[model samples]
Target: MRRGMLSIVLGLALAATACGGSGGAQQGGALQGQRITVAAVWTGAEQDNFKKVLQAFEEKTGAKAEFLATGDNVSTFIGTKIQGGQAPDVVMVPQVGVLQQFARNGWLVPLSADVAKEVDANYAKVWKDLGTVDGKFYGLYFKVANKSTIWYNTQAFQNAGVQPPKTWDEFVKVSQQLADAGTAPMSIGAADGWVLTDWFENVYLSQAGPQKYDQLAKHEIKWTDPSVTKALQTLAELWSKPNFMPGGPQTALQVEFPDSVSQVFSDEPKAAMVYEGDFVAGNIATTGKKVGQDANFFPFPAAPGGSQAPLVSAGDAAVVLKAGKNQQAAQEFVKFLATPDAAKVWATAGGFLSPNKKLDASAYPDDVTRQIAKQLIDAGDAVRFDMSDQAPAAFGGTKGAGEWKILQDFLGNLSDVQGAVQTTAQRLEQEATKAYGS
Candidate 1:
């Protein structure tokens, strides 16, 4: 089956419908006595925050709230429950990439007209559009975080006598400088394929800009395009640089996101900077360091020929299942989630940036978090979702994973640039063609 561009099933389908919109249904459809269960993909401190919100909801509504928590295998559990006919009433998913799949399979209901209208009026059209597929708004998002930014230790940069780089050339120079200073310039984890994908997507955007890259992923343009090849070539240079990356490209596979983040603050911290989403701040805080005071960020630099880039971001969406047994309760829950109060709760509690444009960001205690929020707002229409999560899993999943492995191998053998890229481009084209036939 050639993966249809519109049918690949990515996007935050669960996140979209989690909140019923303004006109979804006021306060009375069917949830009165029915116990509403919530299934979440978060655990640990994150899970506790969600539990608190659910508890608050239960206390306010007098309904029993049951939670099914799965940290990493959530999608598997969700798939199993749905297939087994024991689907939960509400589910929160992190990206629209996976949610689009669920929605295509009829796993979610579109946001009711009342709810849809309010969402359109209140938030940026892109976010609302992210939740809408086939003209149906099926998801709502409370938080959005920038992903294509670099986090650096301020004092470290001060001591190194270099400013944060704002262009790819400058970034390369800084990497060399840090290497000279015996510091791991980049806390990169290429071992984890997704980390490499992050580097690829940012480079692609910085080189090709969003529209063409979007087109390439959708198969409107070929992967062999000069821009994509250029992007990959640039990434190859970074990965190939001697002592340029921490723990080595192979380390990416072994390093978890937190491990990569903690390295930025380690006493003998392997690296002086990290490139990841705003969410890394949470991972850093877990290591007992503070964001803003102890850390700061700069947008990834622009490619030589690329236009000014948009901020790359990712976040979860609250979705209401189409087959949910309690329509009224689910709808009401959606409404509750859209309120300013809900936005505040999500930001402070979940360590996320709220999607509610009207919320007072000053309420956030973390300066880094607040600055991120302000950056998003100031960038306004320039924010784009994480490219991997925005594209189909084939492009962003296994095949994408395969691309990273090839890069890792090539990083160790820089002399094989053409050979490595030629082989990778062919493989990617074949997979994309199979998944998304021309």
Candidate 2:
């Protein structure tokens, strides 16, 4: 089956998440004396921030929401729990592939009438459409990240006398100008395959347009298709220039994601920019540069040939399990997750973005984050989910494998030669065939 779009499962589904209670009356008494268990991979500050959202749910509904850490293997945790008859009542799944699997297996419960209604009104059509799978709604996006923003060092831009560009050709020119001014233009974290995938996704989305983006994501079109080849060649415009990067491609292969962000935002920055999602701010937090002042960003430029550059984004979605003991309570918890009240809990504390359109701009801690969050809501139908995340897990989600590994190799082999780029695309198609088949 084709996957659901980035999804609205948008309104509150489980008001407080799911109560671990043994029984429940209706949505009214769903939370009374119940403890709902929600599983996700968030830890450290991300985890602490969400607890506040859960607490808000608790305040409104008399239910206890429990956090279940699934580490990076949420699928494994859910599978194990299902076998043992101890599966979590609610899951905030980051992988769309896993959600599709659960839905296909009938393990998921559709959103109740009230929950669906709230979602319909609170979210845009794009979110509403993605929420429904084969005509039944299942997942509600809780947190969102904009992957189309390119964060640059404010000092780097000022010293180089370059302004943010609006098209790919202009962006390439600006990057060269930054290099000419004696500062490396980019901090390419080729060490993290997902970062490379994001770079590819932004370029591809802008250059190839949505139809081809969706086709490639679904493997409806091969990776070696002309559209993909064109995207790869465009990326080579920057990736192939060794001097444009802090340590060139090979040295970049040694730098991980956090270090990449740190390198650009440091006291004495090594490069002018780093590209990733809004979550890049999390890594920037550990640096000396302030986000809005010392660090600022612009939306990635559009393609040269008049193609649009839309939002490429990702986030966790809340879904309830049919096997959960407190089914109505689980529904209420998810419903609560869709509200501004719940979103504000995390938004104010930092490092969180929501698809809840009703959420206010002031809820965010800073203008940098508020602007980022606004893009997600404002893009409406112009947004696309992270392409790799929409594909099967073996192909899209694993570490050192599939899209991650193939893109990593492609990053290492960056060149202006058309033939080399085509070869990498072929390799990607070959691996994608196997993973999607499996």
Candidate 3:
């Protein structure tokens, strides 16, 4: 199907139901008067938006859902729940690798037949494949983040007379121009290691393409591969510039992700741009700056000697755990979430992007968000999942994992590119051996 046509069809569907679409209305008969529990890592505003969706489900079907915010370490918390002989009916697994682990451990149950059909019809093959484990469907992808975005302070860009660059060389030149205008060009946020990993992944994917990205994620290629080193060198082009990064690498090592976004939008802004996912929009909103006006974003530019710009993304998948008490009600909720109307609910609430192709782009609350949703759909087969999130937790997801600390150290000293690559390769081998017994 043509990409533009697909987008139009989705937009029409969302527009038609913009006023009175209740996601659970279709399944109210089967789910009435039942209650189920849901567990996920979302909290604060994100949790609130999800709760709105659950409320609609409850209102339509007469079913009740209790939400549990598992914070950042959802796997650890879920494991503890399982060990205690009490688990939530549905869990929002944040990583495909972790979901696969749970499925392999026989802790997850297959989706109900109707929910499976809804997934088959609404999602692209790549999304469905991510939720599948060993030929069985066990999860539903509900929310997505496009990490290949470079958010900028609109006023800063206008004041500096610089436009968003389309290529890496242009990006560096613009950064220099912005610096000359007395604005630090970027916020690094190296304190949180995942942000650093995201930096490396985008450079790698843009430079090495999706095939290499997949191989690296699966550990078929060592971190010391020539492609890996090349990508690191490319990152250093910006990282090594003293005036480009606010407070240099050391300050970045102390800043968390939210603070990083704030740095770009502060009254006296610390930087002109922040490289992160769409979630930054929510953080920007909290600063009382309107998105697309005070702040807006452009796609991360194509790297030198690379393919077209790639979209690096990650999502939360809804999985049914075998230990849950309300299995039937849980299945009903999962099916409801799979519908385009359910996706539209959260999409309209903001700070969410659904992988469900049936959802219309018009359902998004604003142009900035709609643009992001369109970019995700336009990406099609080129969308690559976040590399670190798809790797073993001990190697990538953990706080002090080799991928995190090694990259953090590299950000601290851009001159040690070779040493960083070698150390990362060594640690990855060790961790893979330990985790997989290979």
Candidate 4:
């Protein structure tokens, strides 16, 4: 087994280097000495893993690649750069809506024919559709997040005599069991509305299915739809349980995402589990807990009456900006990133998952990550992009005014589910009218 694993690893490394070498040979002297800037909303370890990918690109193509960490406000920063005529050659946009907006405004360069062909061959149809806008390809989805995971402390579950739940009923029973043992069953970072949005997406996707999820995201269905109510009521089952959440819903609304992870894995754990993306594994490690041993995750179970288990997923797409200084080099770098070989670099680095269908599951460093990659692949068409991220920024992405604030309110007051859903419907209608003048 060890020999076979080593052979697979070596094969991937050779393939990556060969892909990079061929890319350099094709670009030849045109991109050899050019400098290109790439901007992304990554810092710390995430940025570190990305830099390794960039370094490989530079080494292979002989082009200097500069990474600009855009922090959390990439849209603002990218807009400022574009206005100043200094947009990065490649900008990694986290939201498809924003990428489409930029493409529609003519700020993005359509992918070269070669790059488009590579994307078509390497990515799934959904990913291809996401990168293409107005019938033209503009972005390459490189990294993906599996949001249908619930990270848990293994010891905590063992101590509570509860196994990981496989269905929503089981999930509830497990939560109550954990709570009865004097431990908080879950930790929620409702303070970050995005986290709340994720919670709702998983429930909505699983309960209402993808067709309605698509409608809700595109505003074809009102937020007050019966499906919305049903999802919320399902979520409220756990939320309403006494002592099920750490410090209850009010305290959850004050806990940030990192703190929520800490609460689950800390030396004195306040909670047993946290529902979040695969990235939470890294956060668990940071708290001095070993991910596969001390902390691990199970797939979020199917809600009762739901069609199938749903996987709410999100990814960053690399789009070339028309205003960039080195278009040729930028295009080459994006093409490099689209390859399975380039994806393996960061996939093996941990805390990273690629949407490239061609990437090998064996490329991931551990069984936990491998499971995540397999879950994402197995989800296939069942996976839906985070609905809030796909919605208009005014309604879904705004910090304190729209979906975020309203959902935070609901978290603090579970008894007002109908009121909250109705208000969300009205807000979406108003925001959609303003955005589309409809």
Candidate 5:
């Protein structure tokens, strides 16, 4: 979604002319002793790749950058930090709703004009729009994902004699075939509510079409709309059958997101498929299966009204906090993120996609990730951001509440509950109305 930047060698050259002190000679006077702590939901390999960016930053600016793993509930964790006057100097926010909410609350500082200029040069207008609140820039996208994908096990597909399907009916038929052949058809990580939201979004976008999808995302149309009803019914067709999931719905509810991905590629796995963003590749890497041969992905199938699903995408954005003592260093750090060099660090490491138009396609380590990035960039005006991410935190970002909880409830009790689809849609609308005040 954005720009490329200067080499670290340039920073070292420029530092000598800007400062007189021996220590400040190698480090610019402005950022000599600053330490910026960044908070995000990334951990393990995700955090490791990010640390590479931090390593590059320290080499350039002489400021120490440390990462704080805020776990899966980043919005709530950061909110609590801001409330206590202990906010991280920078944050890699995953939700647009959370970014806009923080901006509106005046918790984030406006990025400098230089950062905006870089954004204008490298990113698409849609990316700038997502990071901007009320025409002011408070954040910029760093990494992006194409969420419209379903990864499967090649061995399982071969055993079940099923190819990737193109439509909802065909997908269901394939699922049944896989089940009948004694292959676990799907591995859902319903324990994490966000995964369920991705499922709903892919189906709703494909079936309802873009116009209605946009209306519902902004709450201009209620969740109880006919489009929403149809999407829920479509999802119900799969959720109603316990046989479709590994160890049935109850066991599926206990599995976390990473385990769900690993299972798809595991030897004698509990299940053979997982759905989410392209980031699933990161988890797949640890499972010892090569992508494209042992594990592969296909675009989410088209629903009834659409020939194909539009690309539903999401990205994490970097922002500076006004409350941090190292806010100036934090701004410079965000500025570095705009550069191609920073993106290249993660791109070559796999499981990373940058929105920067200038980032070379050759930077990616593998063809699968490169092609995924190409799909995202080429989607152009056809891209729609995650719908739940566009809604308010109370309605979309909260755990055990809001759309996340409502959808998870619907999935868990699909068959036993009467009128569950309608009930779930009405509940979603109730939360949206309360959160959006519409």
Candidate 6:
């Protein structure tokens, strides 16, 4: 989270000359190009793929695009840079929390009206609308990775004589059956804290529909709602089941959830199922398992006889800065991003789901990916952005990690579920007040 001196220098230089007017100059000196520096939170292979796409952009536009790609503590670093006035022309934050902060602070500007129209015309309006604050669109949502999914081992389910659970009772029955057969039923870890947040979100989806989740995001619904409390209590009950989660509370207190997910992918008497986002595809591939064939998914089911709901999902967005030196150039860059070509580039990258409706899923590398992509697009308006991300900054706050820890503690203890929900809800409300004038 510490600010680097290099960032400080860049911040000073940009502020000195560019603050008074749009700093839209083509690259100075030998750079001799429309130089735009973009920041993203992607790293390693994901980072490499981004570079390739930016290179494609550079080649097509004859503009010089540079990337400030980092993997560690991106939110803090981006916050520091914005505060220091050294913000990039465009920043691709992984979380909506950071984007909302930038919008609130006036660091980001609404997408050009023309850009907004194009986005709405070409894709769903909600994607563009979700990034907005105070009636201005601050970001262009390029891709989304939906998280509310249940991953299962195909062969193990067959061996256990089970079908993908179609209801909540069925889900629990399948898990207990796996446990009775001497196989670890579910792969879960909460050592890093945020892993527990997944359970909160999933149960929240089950108890309260997507619209309620959106209300929770807006702080319109009180945190002490009975539904919210029930969601937390239900997760505690599941976590308390015998041999339910691998290594139980002890291992969860020590391991990251992704590692736990890898266990389900390869380790045997194999784990039967895991609930996670699309990111688990990579972790599974890293374990030498293919997703569609070796592993597959089903949506978390509705309450018995309750209305079926769209899967809970989340996405990342790219945005131009209102205070940036190069507004028009950045706007054009965003246009390029929304095009079919760029959508193809991102789909091929393996970690993203492009929002462009025109990009054919058949073009994806495998059937599993194609099926999932089709499902996401066909999900229509049912897809809700991540609640934590959509929430007012004060409630959603940095406490997501801490809240996850609190959830784990509440689950392990079992007796304190109601108290834990009440306390966390109060704290979140207080933080929201701090973020926005109540």
Position 401, candidate 5: lDDT: 88
Q: What clash pairs does model 5 have?
A: 1-355, 2-122, 2-123, 4-339, 4-340, 5-339, 5-340
- List, residue by residue over 37-84, the lDDT tens digit for candidate 3: 899988877899999888878876667899998877777888889889
Q: Provide the clashing-pair count of each candidate structure.
A: 39, 25, 1, 0, 7, 2
Against the unseen true structure, what C-alpha lDDT does each candidate score? 0.68, 0.78, 0.82, 0.82, 0.80, 0.67
**Taking the tens digit of each residue's C-alpha lDDT, what string does model 2 give over 289-335?**
68988888888888645367768988788889877766766887887
Question: What is candidate 1's lDDT per residue for 267-381, written digit by digit as tens?
Answer: 5678889888777787777777767767788887776677875577677787877656665566556666666666676677647676667668866766767877877766655
TM-score of each: 0.85, 0.91, 0.89, 0.90, 0.83, 0.84
Whose lDDT is higher: candidate 5's or candidate 6's? 5
Candidate 5, 1-438: lDDT as tens digits: 100111233355555443321112234444555688988788777789999988877776677899888877776788888789787889998888778888888888898876777777777777887788888898889988999888999888888888987677888889899888887789999888888888989888888777787788889988888888888887887777657998887777788888898778887777778888888887788899988788888778887777566689998999988777676677778877887777898888777888887789999988778878887787665677899888887888777889888988888777654488889988998899999998
Candidate 4, 145: how far from true, in Å?
Answer: 1.0
User: Which lDDT tens digits does candidate 6 get at residues 1-438?
Assistant: 000111212344333333111112122312225667788877788778778777766665556788886455666777777678776777786666667777787677777765676577667666776777778887787767767677888878887888988888998999988888777888776665555666677678657876787777676776667777677667767777778877776666665777777778875534778777777788788878878888888776765333664466666678887655666667656766766666787677677777677777765777777767776777666677777665543344344433454555665565565566677666555655555555
Locate the minimum summed-lDDT window of 10 residues in model 3.
Answer: 1-10
Top candidate (TM-score): 2
Descending-TM-score candidate ranking: 2, 4, 3, 1, 6, 5
**Model 5 misplaced regions, further than 4 Å:** 1-37, 61-88, 247-251, 325-329, 416-418
Comparing 1 and 5 on lDDT, the stronger one:
5
Model 1, position 86: C-alpha lDDT score: 78
Model 1, stretches more than 4 Å misplaced?
Answer: 1-34, 59-64, 70-75, 247-256, 390-395, 399-401
The lDDT, on a scale of 0 to 1, for candidate 5 is 0.80
lDDT (10s digit) by residue, model 4, range 1-438 = 000001112234333443432243232234456688999988888899999999888877667899997777677788898898777889999988888888998988998876877777877778878788999999888998999999989999999999988888889999889989989999998888899889989999999998999888888876668888788777776687799888889899889999999999999999999999998987898899998899988999888789788898888999999888878778778888888878999988888998877889899999999998889988876788988888777777888867787778777777666665566556656766564445
